[model samples]
Target chain A: MSTQASPETVAPRDGGDGGVPEPSPTAGRSGPRQRRSGGWFVLPFAVCFGLFMLWPVVHGIAMSFTDESLTLAGTSFVGFDNYVEAFGDAAVWNALGNTLFFTLITTVPLVLIALGMALLVHTGLAGQWLWRLAFFAPYLLPVAVVTLIWQWVYQPDLGLANQLLNALGFGPVGWLSDEAVAMWAIALLTVWWTVGFNFLLYLAALQSLPDTLYEAAALDGAGAWRRLWSITLPQLRRTTVLVGMLQVLASLKVFDQIYILTKGGPNDSTRPILEYIYDVGFTGYRLGYASAISYLFFALIIVVSIAQLRFFPRQEG
Target chain B: MTGAHPRRHDRFTVDRRRFLRLSLTASGAALAPGLLTGCGAPAPGGDGVGLKIWDLFSGGDGLLMDEMMDTVRGGPDGFTLDRTILEWGPSYYTKLAMAAAGGRAPDVAVLHLSRMPGYAPGGLLDPFDLELLAEFGITREDFPPALWERAQWEGRLYAVPLDTHPFIVFYDLDVAERAGVLDGAGRLIQPGSPGAMLETSAALAEAHGGAGLLFGHVTDPAQNWRIFNALYAQTGAAFDLPESGPAIDTDAAVRVVSFLQELFDGRTNPNHLDYFGALASFTESRGAMIAVGEWELPTLRSTGIRLGAAPFVNVFGEPAVATDSHSYVLPRQERPDPARRREAHRYVAAMLRQSLTWAGAGHLPAYQPVLAEPGYAELDPQSSYTEAGDLAVLDPPAWFAGSGSLFQDRMSQAIQPALLGRASAEAAVDRMVRECADLLDQPNPVR
Candidate 1:
C-alpha cells in the first residue's frame, strides 16, 4: 500500500521537468545529507509510533494467547482457547455481521450521495456557498455533538422525525428503539455526519477535469448528459474509488456515534465488532478474550483492504 | 554583504533572543503555581488534612453531593476535600478500577454495594478498618443488616453504606386524585395484584389522556433489569446461577416479562420512552405515574408538579423492589499513609451521619440514626418510600451482575425484545437463562 504512491511521485519528476536543470553541487550532496537529517526529523514520530502503536500491536498479539484480565490477577497461557471460543461465539459473529452490514449500507450511499451533491454544486448553482456550508458543516462537529443532535431528532414520540411522519399520516417509528430500524437510523446519521468529506473529494475531482474534452463534445453537439457520462464520470473514477475505500474503512471502524446514541442496542442490533470487543475487554474484564477477538477483526480488515486494492488497482498517470 | 546589513541582522537577532527569553519567563511564571500544586506540597486549602475523593454523581444528585461536601468542608472536622466527579456507569467504574490497580487511587471513592463482590475480589478495593470507623461512631449495627451484609466480601467490610436508592412509584397527585386512585390520606392506593395495578394504570391513563404508568423500558437496560428484577423477586422465586447453569424458576421470569409487556401497552404506558423521556412525561403530567429509582425526585420536584411517592406495591405474592446502595470504599493503596486513611474513615463517617441532606435527592438513608430523625420523617414523598429500602432486592451477587455491569446489559438484551413484542416472554426468559449460563460457564476474570 505504501509503495503504490512511489510510482506517481517518481513519474512526475521523470517526465514533467526533464530538462529543467543539471544537478547542482548542493543538490547532489543533499541526497545523503538530507537522508541523514531526515533520520533526526523522523525520530520523534518514530519513537511515538513505536511506543504507542507498534508495541501495543505486538503486545496485544502476545496477550491474545493468554488469559489476561483487567483485574490484574494471575495470567496464564491459554494457547488457542480464547481463539477457539471466539470462533464459536455467537455474539462475535452477530457483531461482525452487523459491522459488515453497516459498512455496506453506509458506504454505498455515502459514495453515491456525495457524488450527486458534488455534481449538483459543480453545475454553477446559485447559493453555492450556502450549499457547501450546509453540506459540509456536520463533518466539522465532533462525534459527541453529532450524536447529541441526532438523538433528539430520532426521539420516538416527540422527535422531529416522528412529527414529520405523523404530519404525513404515518405512525411514529422507533428510530433508536426498534431492533430492525436502529441500525438504519445510525447509518443515516453517520451518512449525514461524514458524507461531506467524500463530497469535497468528488467536487475537487470534478473541478480538476480538463474542459477540452467537454468543449470538443459540445462542438460536436453532444448533450449535457452525454458529456457527463463520457467525460465527467470517467474522470472522477479515481475519486469514487478513493471515497468508497475510505468510507468503507470508516464505517467498519465506527464506534463513537453508535456508542453514544444506542450503546449498540435495541438488543445489540447495532453493535459493531469494535463495541463488542470493548464490552468484553473493559466492561466484562476479559481482556485476553477481547484481544483475541480484536486480532480476528484485524485479520478480517486486512483481508478486506487487500481485496479492495486488488479489485480497484490505482491508475498511475 | 554591507556592514549596515550585518548590524541590522545582529539587532534583529538580539531582539528575537530577548523576546524568546521574555516569553519563557512569562510561561514559567504562569506554570509555577500549577506545577507546585501538582506536586502535592501546599494543598489547595492549606494546613488541613487533605483527602482526595472520587464520586460518580451528576445532575440533581451531583448538586446535592456538592452541597453535602460543602457542609462537611465547613464543619468542625478541619479536612480539605478534593473531589473528582466522573461520569456515572461503566466509564467511572473502569477508571476507578484502573486507578486502584495502579496504586494511585483516591483516598476514598464511591462504589455501588452491588459492585463490591467484583471490586473486592479483584483487590481493587481495600477493606475498611472497622475499628477506625467505629471510632467515628459508625458500626455494623448502624446500617440495615441486608445492606450491611452486602458491604462485605469474605467477612471483611470493604464499603460504608451511604444510601439505598430503590425502584419506587412516583405519581402525580392531581392525576391520582382525579382518577380516584388516591386513598383518604392523599396517598397512592396500593395496588395489591397485577390486575389491580393494571386497573389503576388504566384509570390514570384515561384521566391523563396518555400512558398511566411510564417505565422507560426502551433502550435502557439498567432500568429494564431493575423493573424485571423487582417484579421477578415478587414471585418469591429463587434465582441462582451456578457453573451448571441458571437455577431460576423460568415461569417466574416469564410472568414478570409478560406483566411488563402488558404494562407497556401503548395506551396504558408508552412503549418507546427511554429514561429521560419517562422523566419528562411524568414531569409534564402526561403520565400519571412513573416507576423508577427515586434519584429522579429532585428533577420532578423542580418542575413544580404535585408529586406523590410510594413504595412499590405488592403485585405478586411477595413484596420486593430492586435497589442498590451508594457506598464509600477505600480504593487499594500501597503503603497507605495512616493519617490520610484515618481522614478517609472520618470523612465517610461524617458523610453517613449527615446523610439526611443526601436524602433530599430521594435516596433513602442507610444510616439508622438519620432515618430515625424527625427531619427524615418530615421529608415528604421521600419518606413515603422508606419501606422500599427494607424491601430492597439488589442484583444477585456475581462478578458480572451489578449496576452498569455486563450482566445488566445482557439482561436488557434478553428482555427488551420481549417488552417490544418482538419476542415471546418465554423466549426472553430462555435467552436470559442461556446468557446467564454462558457467563457462569466462563472463568471468573476477577479471581
Candidate 2:
C-alpha cells in the first residue's frame, strides 16, 4: 500500500514551488518498479483495518436506518425513524448540550494552562526537570487511575478537597453530586489529567524557535512582556492554533472520566453525548438509534474539523 | 416404515455421509481463527463433556463460585467446566447478547433475573426442560414461588435461579444499640412507619455527631430506584400498564419522593454520598443505617463492623421490598449439542444444591433446601432477612427495567436532584413520569 500510494503522495510535491528540498532526484525512479511487489506487505494491515475499523463504520451507518437491537435477531428498516426519534429526543439534546458545554469549559483551560506551563518551564526555571516531569506526569497515567484519584479527592464527606477546604474555613462542596458543580468538577479533572499532552506540544514548539529572534527583540529596547507579545506570541501562533484544534476535538469526546466518576448524573448533568449513545445502543438495546445519534455526532465533528481547517488555513511556514 | 426406503437408501446414506463430512470441514475452517486466537478456549475433546460457562461474579461472590466449581470438579458426573469471568454490568450482558446473536454463546452463563426478559424474548437464551432437570434431582419446588415465576417466560423456564438479593436496610449494630434503636436480641427494632424510620435516623444521627442515615442515591439512579420501589411497594400502589404507556401512581411517587427528600435533608441523612462513599460512611460509623440491596452484604461484613439487617422501612403501609435475583441461563447456540446441554443442566443442579455455600455471600438462596438447612438459621444477617424473600417486589417486566438498565439510570437522575434538594420533589416525580412514559412509548424490539 505504501509503495503504490507513495507516487500519488509525491506527485503533488513536484508542482509545489520548491517547498521541500530534493535530497535525490533519482530516488523516485525506483518507486513504480516496487509497487507490485509491495502490495502483499500491506495486506495484513488492510485486512485488519477493513474488519475492525472500516467494517464497523459501514455497519453502523447501515444499522442507523433500521430498528436493529443488540438482542433481537431480526432487524427491519424504518427509514429515518431512528434519526427522527434522536432529533426529537430530549435526552439526546440534553447530552449534546452538556457535551458542548463540557468542551467549552475544558478546551480553554486546557489550552491556556498548557501554554502557561510551557512558558514557565521554558524560562529556565531553577528546577526545570521537576517542573517538566510534574507537568507531564498525569498524562502518562491511565484515565481510570486519574479518575480514581480525583474521585477520592472530590469525595464530599472525607475527600482531600473538602478536608482542605474545611481547614481553609470554606464549606464542603458536592463536587460529584451537585448538578451545577459536577460538570465543572469533571472538567477540572480532565484539565489536570490531559493538559500534559498540550503542554508537551507547546514546549516542543517553544524549544524549536530560533534563539536569534529573542536576541533581536532584546536589542530593540524591549521588555520581557514586549518580547513575548511581538516575537514569542507571533512565532507561537501556528502551534496555538494546532493545539487549540487538537484540544477541542479531545474535549468533545469526553466519556471515560465522567463514566468513572459520575456515570452522567446527579441527574444526567454531566452526561455527554457519547454516554447517551452508549446508553441508547448498549443499555437500551437500541442499536439503530444509537448509530443514528453517533452519526449525527460524527457529522458534527467533521464539520467542526473542516471549519477549523478553513479558519486556520495552515500558516505558510 | 423403517424399511420403506431400503432399496434406495444405499446411495442416500453415502450422500448424507459425504455431506456431513463436507460441512464438518467447512465449520472447522470457519472456526480456525477462534481456535488460533485465545479469545476463548476450545472444548476439551474426550469422553467427558467440556462445559463452557461465563459469569460476572468477582470478589467474595467470585470466590464462592470458585469453591462451588471445585466441588463440581469432584462430582461423579464426567463433566469439566471451563469458566470465564467477565466484567460485571452492561458490558457482560452486551458480550453475552453478541455471542448469542453470533451463535457461539457458552453452554451456560449467569444472568440477573431482571435481565431474563430482555434476553429470553430475543432468542438469546434457551428454555430449560423441567423433566431433564428433574433427572438431575432438581425441580420447581426447590425455588421460591416468586423466583421460580421470574425465571420463567411465557410459561417456560429460561433460567435456574441461584439466589434473590432483596433491598434491605443494614444498620451499624453498635451505633443502633447506642442510639437505642436495637431490640434486646441486638436486632433493629423494625420501623412500623416512615415517620418512625426517620425518627430512628434522627436519633442515630444525634448519636453519631449529626451524621444521618446514608443511602447511595447521590449519583446512582438505580440505587435511588431500589429505595423508591421498595417504598412504593409499601404503598399498595402498582403501575398500570397499557399499550400506550405505563400509568404510574403519581401521588404515590410524589409522596415517596418527598419522604426520601426529607430523609436526605442532611439533618438526619446526609444528602451527598455515592454507592461506595455511603458504604464507607456506614462502616466508618458516620452513618447509622444504609438502605441498599443485599449484594452489599459481603462488603458490609468485611468492614468488621457489627452490622444488623432489617427489612426496608415501610413508609406507606406494607412490608414490600425491591429485589433482583441471580440465576443460571443457557445462552442460545446455533447448534446446541445434546451432550453439552445435559452437562449444563447437571452443573446448574449441582450449583443449586450447594446454595448454602452461596448463602455465605449474603444472598438469600432461591433453593428452598438451603433455607431448610439446619445451619442456615444460624446465619446472622441471612436469617434476619430471609422473610424479605416472600415480600420481594421485583422491577416491572420491561425490557428497559433492570439493574444497570437505562430505566434505573434515568429514574436516579430524576430523583437525585430532589434528594440533594436541588429540585422540588414534585418536579422530580414529574420528570420520572415523563421519562417512564418516553421509555414505554418506544417500541420494544425484543417483543
Candidate 3:
C-alpha cells in the first residue's frame, strides 16, 4: 500500500487494524537514548530555527493583538484594534491592489514565455547549451543587482529605453516614473529578472518527457504548436503547477526589486505588501500594526497557496 | 551537555493572541509581554552590558563619525561599545523604530533636530535632563538661541543640537562670468531678490542652453517642502497652526506655490530633477546655476569650478532658506549604571566639540561658539549663509519630516504637480493642505 499509490494521503494505522504495526516495548531505547539523554544532537539547529523563524512568527502573531510601538514600554491589549485600523487603512487596500496587479501581470506571461523558451531549447534546438546558458545566466545575479541593471535600463532620461524612444522621435515615456506605468514597469522588470528560473525548470521538465509521445505526434503530423498544446503541456502538467505556485508565492512577496527601483513611489503607486509591512513595522514604528498586516498577509498567502495546492491536485500513478 | 530532551523550550511558548486575549480577558500589564521578533542569536557579547549605538551616516561624514567613535573607544572611557549602522531613508527609520519598540534598543543614537519634536511627546525619547546635559558642556548658550529653541520640547531638550545643514544655491563662478551672470568680485551674481534670481537664472540658461526653468529636485521632496516652507515663512505663514491643525490651504502657501510654479515659465528651467554634476559643470561653464546644499561647495571647488552660495531666493518677501539640524541623542539603557552613563556623556561632549570638524562636512555647527571661532567664521558657504539660521528657515517639526526621507513623500505629491504645471498653484496648495491633514490623521504612535 505504501509502495504503489499516493504520497499525500498516508494515514496512521491504529492498533488492531490489519495495517497497524505492533508496538515493541523494548525495541526502542529504554536505555540512554530512550531517556533522550542525547537530545543535544538537535540542539544547535533547534536553537537557530526556533530563534529565527519560529520566534518572529509567534511574536508577530501576538503583536497583532495590541496597540504596540517601538517607542512604548508597555503595550495595551487593544483587542482587534489593529485589525480594525487595518480595515480602514487605505494603504492596506492600495498595497493589496498593487500586489494583485503585479501577480496578474507577471504570472501568466512568465509561465508562457518560460515554457516557450524551454520547448525551444529542449526540442533538439541548435546551440542548446548557449541558449540555456543565456537564459540561466540572469537567474544567478542577486535580486539587488538585477534591479539595479533594470533600473538603469528603465530610467526616464538617459536610459536605454528612453534613449531609444527619443532616437525614434517618439515621446520619452516615463517607464518607472509615471504613476500609471510604474507597476507595469516593475512587472516587466520582474519578468526579465525571474523568467530564467522558471525557464530552467520548464527546460528540465521538457527534457525528462519521453521522445515516444513526440515521435507519435510527428508521425500523426501534429504540428509543433499542436504537439506543445497537446503532448508537451499534458506531460508538463506537474512542472507547470509547481512553477505557477512558486511564481505566485514569490511574486506576492516581491520586495527587493520594488525597493531598489521604484521605492513604491510616484505617489506610493508602486507600494507592495512586503514594502508596506516594512514601512509600518520599521518606518511607522507601529510594530503591532505592522505585525497585524504581516500576519494578514501571511494568511492571505497561505490561503492562496492552499487553493493552488488543491486546485492542481497532483495525480498518482 | 545539560540540554534536556530539547522539547524546544522556545516553541509552544504563549501565543501573542492568547496572551493579549488573556490580558484582555484579565487586565493590562498584568503579564509581561515578550512580543519580540526573530531574536536570532544573542548579540555578540550580549552579556557584557555594552552600550549599543546606532546611526545612519555614510561617505565622508560616515568616515568622520567612525573616527570620532574611534577616538571615544581609544579614550579612557570605561564602557564597551556595540554599534550598528543602518541604511539611510525609510529603511533607517523603520529599523530604528522597530529596535526602539522591540525594547532591544541602542543606548545612544542620532536624529535630525527637525525630527526630534515628533518623537518627544510620543515618549519615544527620554528627554535629556538639563542638568545632565550641562555636565557635557552643552547648555542653551552653547547653541544659537533659535536652534536651542527648536531643540526643546515642552521647555525641555529632547535632542541636543549637533549642526545645521541647510540648502545653499551652488553656482560656478567661471561659467557665471562667461554667461555674464557674475559680479565684479569674480563671485557668481548673488541674487538677493526673486526677480534677480529669475533674471540670473534666465541669463544663465540662455548662455548655457537649457531646460528653461528652476530644476525642482523631485526625487527629494523633503527639500522641496522646505523650499515651500521657507517662502511661506517669509510671508509670515506657518505650516501648521497646531492648535487649528495643519493649515496648508493658507494664501501664503498658495503664493509660495504660485511663485514656484511661475519658475517653470519658459524663461527658466523646467527640468523636474537637479543634477549636481550637471550644475557644477554648468557653473564651470558646463550647464547653469543650480540650488543645492552647501555640502556640494567642496565638490564644486575641487572640480576647480568657481562657486557661489546663498539662501534660496525669497519668493514671498523676506530672505528665507530651508534649514535642518542634526543632533546626537542618548537612548535609554535597561540597566543604567552611573559610570557607563558618564562615559556616554563624555562621548557626547567630544562629539559636540568635534562638531566644528563636522561642520566641514557642509554643516554650520549648532554650537554657536564654533561660529565665533575663526575656523567657522572663515568657513566658505557656512559663513556665507550662516545668517539663514537667525531669520532662518526649516521644515515643520514632524516625525515624517527628516532624513529618513518620507519628508519627500507627499510634498512631492503636492508640489511636483504645480512645479510641472500639472496643477495650478491654488489647487496644489489645497492638495498639499489636504495631504498634511491626512498625514496628521495618521495615528502612528511614536516608539
Q: Write the per-residue lDDT of candidate 2 for residues B19-82, one digit (tens) a residue.
A: 2222211222323333332246344333453688889888788999899888888946645878
Give the alpha carbon lDDT tens digit for every residue of B42-77 in model 1: 333334646878898977889989988898889466
- Which is the better candidate, 1 or 3, if ranked by DockQ? 3
lDDT of 1 at B80: 89
TM-score of chain A of each: 0.90, 0.90, 0.84
Expressed as tens digits, the lDDT of each residue in A1-317 for candidate 1 is 22224423432232222333444455566778787887998999899756545556667778889998777588999999999999999989999999999999999999999999999999999997788889989999999999988888987777889999999999988899888899999999999999987887777667767789999999999999998898899877766766776677778878889888888897789998888887887777777888888878877866775566446542312
State model 1's lDDT.
0.81
lDDT score, candidate 1, position B29: 33
List residue ranges in candidate 3 displaced over 4 A: A1-55, A221-223, A314-317, B1-53, B67-84, B98-107, B129-136, B180-195, B211-216, B219-221, B241-244, B265-267, B274-286, B297-302, B405-407
Which whole-number lDDT from 0 to 100 does residue A178 have in model 1?
A: 88
lDDT of each: 0.81, 0.79, 0.65
Ranked by lDDT, top first: 1, 2, 3
